[model samples]
Target: MTQDDMPRTVRTLLRELDRASLATILPAEPAGWPYASLVLVAVDHDLSPILLLSDMAEHTKAIKADGRVSLLFDGTGGLDQPLTGPRATVLGRAERIADDRLKARFLARHPDAALYAGFKDFAFYRLTVDRAHLVGGFGKIRWIEAAELVPPQAEGLAEAEAAIVEHMNADHADAIQLYATKLIGRAGDGWTMTGIDPEGIDLRRGGEVARLAFDEPLRAAGEARKALVALVGRARALP
Candidate 1:
C-alpha cells in the first residue's frame, strides 16, 4: 500500500488495540540464542507502549541488557474467528524513566494498574517507536514511518477547546439531544465537549457514551460556538 493509506490504517490499529504484548529479545545466555517474553502494556499519548515491570522480572533484566524490542498488538485475540480485524507490530528501543510526571500521565489512563505502580520493584518503561507495520484487514498492509504516523499538536487549540465545552454544556443542550436522536439514534439528556483540535471535536452525550468527532474543521472558537447554537435552533425549529 502507498504511504497515503498508512495513516487511516494506523488510526484503526490504535482504536482497536487497547492492550499489547511487548517482546524483549534477550542476549544469548550460556545455553546460546536469545528468548522472547510477552508483557501486557498500555499505549501512551505518543503511541509508545507503557510497560510496568519489576526489577526481578526476567524480561526487565533482558531489556536492560539489550534495549531492542518489538510490540505486537493483535485485535483478533478475543474473537473466535481468525484475522477478523487488524494486527500491528511496532519496533523500537525501550527506556526506563523515574520521572513522576510521566508516570502520572500513564497511570491516569491505566488506573487498574495502580496496584503495581507503587511497588518498589515495579518501574515504568516506554518504547520509543522507530518503525511500524500495520495490516488493516487481508489485502491492506503498509509500513508506517514514525514521522508520518504521529499527530502533531494542534495550533491555537486551548481557547477553542475551552469555548467548545462551555457552549456545548450551556446553550446547546437541545442540539446535543438532537445529535443523540438523529445521529446516534438514542435519547440523551445532556452533553459534554471534552477536547477539540484541527481534526475534530470530541463530545460526550449522556452517560459515558462513545466519543464523537466533527468532520469539518471548526474555524475558530467563536465560529464553533455560533455553529452549535445555530444547530440547536434549527433542530428545535424542525417538525
Candidate 2:
C-alpha cells in the first residue's frame, strides 16, 4: 500500500475488525493508570467507533469520569512479525449516546450481543475521533487528522445503507456469494452484506468477515448501486 492508501487501510481495519483493545484512564485511588479491555466495536458511516458497554463495566465508569480514551485495532493476526503488520490507535472522547441507529449498527456487527443489549445497564457510546496514529509498516507511519481520515458524509448513504444491505441479502444472495468467492477469492457460501459505506461493503459468512473496497470512493446511494453492479461484473469476468 502506498502512502495515499493509508486512510483506506485505516478505515478497512476499523470496519473489518470485530473487536479491539479499549484503553481508558483508571478512575480509582491509584488513578491515572491505563486500563485496557477487550471490546466489540462497530463504525458509523463517518468511521467513528461505536461501542456497547454496561454501566457496571470499569471502562464505562472511567468514561463517565473522563471521556478520553484510545482504541487499538490490531491487524497483525497470523503475521510472523507482528510489528510488520498494520495497526491503528484512535484517540477520542467516548460519550454515551441514545441514537437507535448506532445501537442497531453495533448489534448488526455483533448479533450475539443482542441478547443483553436491552438490559437497563447497557448503553451505546460513540467515540468522537480527535485523530489517529497509523503504522502501516516500518517506514509507513503517520498521524492522520480526523478530517483527513474520514470522508465527508455522503448524502443519504447512511440512511440508505440498511435497506440496500437488506435488498442484497434478501434478493441477490448469489451475487453476494460471488463477491466473496469469485471476486475476493474466498471459498464460502452464505456470505451476506452487513453494511455498506462510501468506502466499501462489509460481508459476513458465519464468524468470518470480509471487506471489499471500491476502486474509488462513492458519494451517494445511486453511485453505490453502480459500483456494486460493476464489481460483480468484474468478478464474473475473472477466469
Candidate 3:
C-alpha cells in the first residue's frame, strides 16, 4: 500500500506530534457550537492523545459537560505551502485520567507540564479516538476508522515500559544513537529512548523528539527486542 493509504503512517504522524488544535462543544452556546484552541499533547500507550487541561479553560469546562471532542494535527510543511502536506482530525470523547503512570508518561514528553501538573485546577485527559478524517495533500483524503487510528495495545506491555526504557538507555545507548542518526536521519549522540508501545518507539534528544515505527506492530517484549535488533541491523547497513 502507498504511504497515504497505510493506517500505520497516520498513527505514526500522530504519535510523533506534540501539539494539536483541540475542538470542543461550547456548552453555553445556543447551538452547542465548536470552539477550537491550541493544546499541548502527548501520545498515550493506547495510541490516544493525552492533554493537560485547566479546569478554568472554556474548552476544558465544555469537555467536562460534553465529552465529545476533536483534535486537528496538520503536518503541512508551512502556511506558504499549505496544501502540499497532510492533516488529520481525530474524533473522540475526552476523559480525565488520574493514573500516576499515565501522568508520568505524559510528563516525560512534556516536562513543562510539571509546573502546573500538581495544581488542583489542572488535570490530564485522554481522547478516546472514535474515528478520524485524514487529508493527505490534495487528492488523498479518507475517513479512517478509529481502529485504524487507535490500535490495540499488547497484553502486559504497559507494565514493561519502564524496564524497556531503562534497558535501552542504560545498556544500549549506542544503539539508540545509531537508530536516531542512521535510520531516522537525526544527527545527535544524546538520544534517549523514552517510551515504546505496540505502535512504535519514542526517542528524545535535547528538545527534539523522534519516533521509530516497527515494520509491524509488536505484542510483547520479545517482539520488541527482535524489532529493535533488526532496526539496528538495518541502520548499520545504511552506509
RMSD of each: 6.0, 1.4, 2.4
- Per-residue lDDT over 1-239 for candidate 1, one digit per residue giving the tens place of the 0 to 100 score: 46586765664464334456767765546322455566656554456667788898777887888888877777665566657567888888999977664475455435557888898898999888888888767777777888876753444544355555556657766666675565545565665554444444444542243333344545544456555555456556666
Model 3 has an lDDT value of: 0.84
Model 1, poorest ten-residue lDDT window? 205-214
Tens-digit per-residue lDDT, 133-180, candidate 2 = 999878989988888787645688888888898899999998899899
Which pairs, if any, clash in model 1? none
Best candidate according to TM-score:
2
Query: Candidate 1 vs candidate 3: which has greater lDDT?
Result: 3
How would you order the candidates by lDDT, starting with the best? 2, 3, 1
Candidate 1 lands at a TM-score of 0.63
Best by lDDT: 2
Q: What TM-score, to 2 decimals, does candidate 2 have?
A: 0.95
Query: The CA-based lDDT of model 1 is what?
Result: 0.62
Query: What is the C-alpha lDDT profile of model 3 across 86-191, one tens digit per residue?
Result: 8888899999988877887788777777999999999999888898888877777888887666665777777778788889999999999998999899986799
Number of clashing residue pairs, candidate 1: 0
Estimate the overall C-alpha local distance difference test score of candidate 2: 0.89
